[model samples]
Target: MDTMRDRFAPVVSQVLDEDPRVAVVLAEIGAADFQETARRHPDRVVNVGIREQLLVGAGAGLALTGMRPVLHTFASFLVERPFEQVKLDLGHQGLGAVLVSAAASFDWPAGGFTHMAPGDVALLDTLDGWTVHVPGHPDEAETLLRHAIAAGDDRVYVRLSLQANRAGHPVDGKRPLTVREGRSGVVVAVGPMLDAVLAATEGLDVSVLYTTTVRPFDTAALRRATASAGTDVVLVEPYLAGTSTAVVNDALADLPHRVLGLGVGRGELRRYGTLEEHVAAHGLDAGSLRERISAFLARRDAVPAAS
Candidate 1:
């Protein structure tokens, strides 16, 4: 099966061929993949070499000229290094651009710490009006990419990753899809973390809510799930742990609830290991998630109900 990043070039290429107003800006990361596309649309596809800031600036410039720009690079450089350009050129200017990032979190551990970007989503969260999509499968990635492109002058970020689930879930880019129903609690799995979350919550009486769209978070769906199941939630993300905990808290502020945010921890793992090893070390594996989720739910269940 092709990874989300693997599916990005073809989808963008097709969009470029179909839409005249669409432009792609690259920072020398995945330029090779778009060599043919660049040749086809010399004016639309642009490569700004190793300059990450220039890549974002050029995309913003394109957006300013009434063209929808899609920017691509590794997450570390795309969002982290060029964050000022993103904040000023895009956000402050109120321009729309599809920022597509590859090598999510720890996809390229061998490339060392510089390539990892577990806080990309969290960083974007600090800014306002940014739509974020974290697709679990390549199909979902394609869907979200198309959705972002047609979003019409809205700031959008489509996070691509080498990690993916066994199958793609139906994503409408509006609300969360309920994967399983139960009365205990709700496990909200984001992006590539769905499979581990499902495996962890198996045989448990917890509802599973899957979503590729994180920004403009589905508060309604979450409220509905929590209303049926008790006010307990476990957010399992592929990025930094507790990244969405604040949003979850605000969403459930009216009701008394317990939320356990699970994902990549902030602690840096100096060792360059396999992806599976990193997952295990971060306690994001199925067994670890199960233990943590079960424990948190057990504690919540132990609490006496208000009379």
Candidate 2:
């Protein structure tokens, strides 16, 4: 099984390789992984060193010169390290640049908390005219990338990961990834964990809300998803709870709804383990989620149904 990066990089590399005017800009950290793609299309790769501000600025400059640029970097650095450049050079100027972020959230276990980016979803949501995507799986990532490349939008920041994903998951390029009937008590998954959520909810009356476009979200579709949901709505995200907290808060502000935001809480994530073990350690395994959901249902049943 290939990592999400491997799955998407090749497909995109193939497309960009065919386009003569397309170029790629990489942070020093990302160059090693995508070197082959850059090598194959030598005229395309631009290495911008440790300076992310310059990296984004240069990408904007290159895009203004008629070359389509895909800027690659760590999610943490992409947001915190270069906020000014991204805001001024990319968002404000409305320049065309596809920002490809790798190892989003806790995808980089070795990098620790400082590098773990949990605030991107909320941060990017505030940027006007910028397209934000958080692909749940590789195929979805590929589809989102293809659209972003062709979109010619001023700014597009993709929240990506190197996590492994099972193949053959259906990805809706036009709308949110809906796995079941848009019904009551939906499970909104942000990453490859949607598969686990599906397995856990087998035989249960719950909908799976798969979100690839985080910012500028399709509110209409989301509203329709919960139109039947009388209160049992939950959002299962891979990032920290705060990521979904803001989204759900804002989403429910005007409506009478109960939204549960689930995610990795304050804890020390195991450093020495396979991705599966880490997932288990974080309560992201299928079995743990199933247990939690069962308990939640039990509690709901114990409660006197409103009125």
Candidate 3:
């Protein structure tokens, strides 16, 4: 299923075909790299040159004209070149458009840092009214894409990773479910890191909450999940420690919550390797998570119960 391009391609094509009023713009730098569906639906797909800023600005213009635009490009180019357009035209103007970012995170390893986007999450996460959804699987991708197409939200950003196989299930926009629940401690897991968190918490009392939607995170559910746990809830995200992560940590200020941020680390990831290797290096793998969880539990136990 790794190279199954035909699988999700048709789903995206079908959506573009169904919506006659909206425009689906796709901009790719190289040949043989464009989306199959966007190619199939040629009328809707907009092929701007290698310039990503113009691509996003054009999408914003389309959105201003009452046409819902879906901006498609690699996560690296989408956020890098079009920072002003995305932040001003779409975000500031409150255009109801969606940015479909591909190769999110280490999705493209052989392509090097220019291709890999292990930092896109932290970028869009900072934008106001920008909803970032990273579908862990193809089914989740299809469902989330459909929702974004129909949603009237101000702006939407969907990040697609190489580990899309683990996206699990398609959550309803109305009622998002709790993927995993624990008692003693709550681990707010996102992206493919859930695999690590889940494996580590085996036979443990910690609860794992996998968030598919970042902006509209189920705060109500989070509050309910951490209600009984009290001081054991830990807010974790794949982004390095920053405003977005800090805001999340601060959100649970009322309840004693510890934030364990997992990301590509503070400095540039100078080492070139596979995603697994990167995860191992960054201590986001199952083994590292287990050790961290064990240490956290030990520290908690060290503190005596109320007298």
Which candidate comes out best when scored by TM-score? 1
lDDT of 3 at 78: 88
- lDDT of model 3, residue 170: 52
Clashing pairs in 2: none
What are the models' TM-scores? Answer: 0.97, 0.84, 0.87
Worst 10 residues of 1 by lDDT: 298-307
Go through the candidates in order and give each one's C-alpha lDDT: 0.92, 0.71, 0.66
Candidate 3 worst ten-residue window by lDDT:
2-11
Taking all chains together, the TM-score of candidate 3 against the true structure is 0.87
| Alpha-carbon RMSD to native, per candidate | 2.7, 3.7, 3.9
Q: Model 1 clash tally? A: 0
Report the C-alpha lDDT of model 1 over 1-307, residue by residue, as the tens digit: 9889888899999999999999999988889999999899999999999999999999999998999999999999999999999999999999999999999999999999999999999999999999999999999999999999999899999999888999998898888999999999999999898999989999999999998999989888999999999888889999999888888889989899888888899899999999889999999899999999998888865652210
Give every collision pair in model 1.
none
Candidate 3: segments with Cα more than 4 A from true spot: 2-8, 29-42, 165-167, 174-176, 241-244, 301-307
TM-score between model 2 and native: 0.84
Report the error of model 2 at residue 229, Å.
3.5
How much is 271 displaced in model 3, in angstroms? 2.8
- Using lDDT as the measure, which candidate wins? 1
